[model samples]
Target: MKGRSILLDHVGEREAAALMVDGKLEDLLIDDDSQPRPGAIFRAICDRPLKGQGGMMLRLPEGETAFLRQSKGLRPGQPMLVQVTGYTEAGKAVPVTDRVLFKSRYAIVTPGKPGVNVSRSIDDEEDRARISAIGHAVMEGIEHGLILRSSCAGADDDDIAEDIAAMADLASAVLNDLEGTEPEALTEGDGPHVLAWREWVSAAEVVTDEGCFEDHGVMDQIEALKSPFIDLGEGHMYVEATRALVAVDVNTGGDTSPAAALKANLAASRMLPRALRLRGLGGQLAVDFAPISKAHRKQVEQSLRASFRNDAIETSLVGWTTMGLFELQRKRERLPLAAILRGL
Candidate 1:
């Protein structure tokens, strides 16, 4: 329990995966089989463009529609390939993008962007050069770009080459079906089990048994996420989701010392990302930190920056509001766990 461990299990009948680090739940992925999943590739037909939004609606197979925000030079009925980018709210169009990427464990093939690049985290010059050479060789004549992931740093050379080649081949195969007239799905996105294997590349013990969730305490952790209150030892925070945005209110509890406000604010900031990730909460987030002096604002901001830096979801710190609240805009990548587990 000291190191990382991946729990491959289910919440009700849906496939689920959990990342446990040192006995704490670090991340969670659960399947929502009702709609087109994020990262799924589809050949769609352009429907119509929004007047002032500069975006277009796409018609997919089975009467589903997606919204593409960067639709320029696109005409109605034009056929094109698109990839689902994120989850959709009820009755809302599935958000998609024309920039389709074929991602695997070690490589990501970027169509229309031709370059061989290594992850910036791999700081060793020799390792970067080696990875670059492998990518360039595997993608010599291919038009698609290749990005070597950070996991390739100490991985076997043969495995890295194989992964790159396989993703490139898959991308080519999918891109070639653009001539099809009828809208259809090219590839379904990876399920929770496969996604955990692909994204959680760090060394960890794998648990695939049926009762792994209950055995490893993942079920208990998930139950805690169902509530909005989070205990931070010295203080607590309430994370409430509204239709417009998520509201986080931090309290110093009984601590009334001069540093109590700063302490509670820092604790909330450190735990905020993990809480949101577990609950699959996104969109706008407004945090009402306990009252602290203007001089301590920088410290709180830095804490937030450091906490969100490691989060996989895309989040932008939009700075402080006039009312002294912190705001953030996060991409809605996954369905809310409560919604997924509803009625179960």
Candidate 2:
């Protein structure tokens, strides 16, 4: 696979990074860690006792109350390792977990769960078995469990093993250091742009524009993500995010031919994932492609799947809805791009 150039533009409160693929904004990343989001692991001190789900909360060292799982028995002043699992909205306590997840390029090393597992996205049985065997062999005596990523599909066994071993060392070091460290984040999982391009792109391919994000066309692209409609010359896509799911609608105005509709929908399908990543839209997503005949729907679906296949984030096509909407889901580990910008 060919690599894409990366541009980091730091202009406003939140810095934006654009992955330039084929001269287009393929992926967008924003630095908006003003508050914790999902997958953020923090070493927190419990300031109060946690009760049932009605109003259970734990005060962190930062003088903020975080949502505590009702089932866990926690007391005041108890130091605990908590990972944010989900955050529904801004200014609200996020759902958290005690399980600490350490992610690497090719695997996620999780403590307490010992064994090797393949990513569910890798559907090839042979590849899964091969990666699993390699994972288990490399992680045999380690206390942490390993999850082989899809990127490791065709990787050499030795390379995979080495990466796993390195992650194990990092995990052990992190766990050991948690004893005396102040309340702080330990590590961060790779986002789509970083995970997809960092290793593949050269130093020259990665460029940074400090305080010039708005000058180099990056601001325009970032602004596009905030709008509900994205014009694509031949067609336009409408993006709507509700509390429940992210919905996308593809429309081809003034063109009614089957081929024209297919072309427009295909373009929209390719653009949708990039928009989703740029906007940090995740959870359940439904894309309603322009009405196409049953014979051509499969082609559009395949194209959409292909578009998402290259994404660093794991995504799955869950078939079409009864109403002819294309259904899919993407992994949500951080605040949406829009939310991050909103925080700024």
When superposed on Cα atoms, how far off is each prediction in RMSD?
Answer: 1.1, 5.4
Summing lDDT over every window of 10 consecutive residues in candidate 2, give the lowest-scoring window: 195-204
Segments in model 2 whose C-alpha atoms lie over 4 Å from true places:
1-3, 44-59, 63-80, 85-87, 115-142, 145-166, 177-204, 209-216, 294-296, 316-319
Please report, in order, the local distance difference test score of every candidate based on alpha carbons.
0.93, 0.72
Residue range 1-344, candidate 2, lDDT tens digits: 13456776664655556666655666666666555655667776665544444334655546656776653566665667777775456577666777778766687898998777888978989988999988888877787888888778777888788888888987887777556434656655444345434333323366665644555466777777778888877788898888889998889978877577898888997887777777777789988888889899989988888888877677888988889998888777556776777667
Residue 113 of model 2: what lDDT? 84
Task: Report the C-alpha lDDT of model 1 over 37-115, residue by residue, as the tens digit.
Answer: 8999999999999989999999999999999996789999999999999887889999999999999999999998989
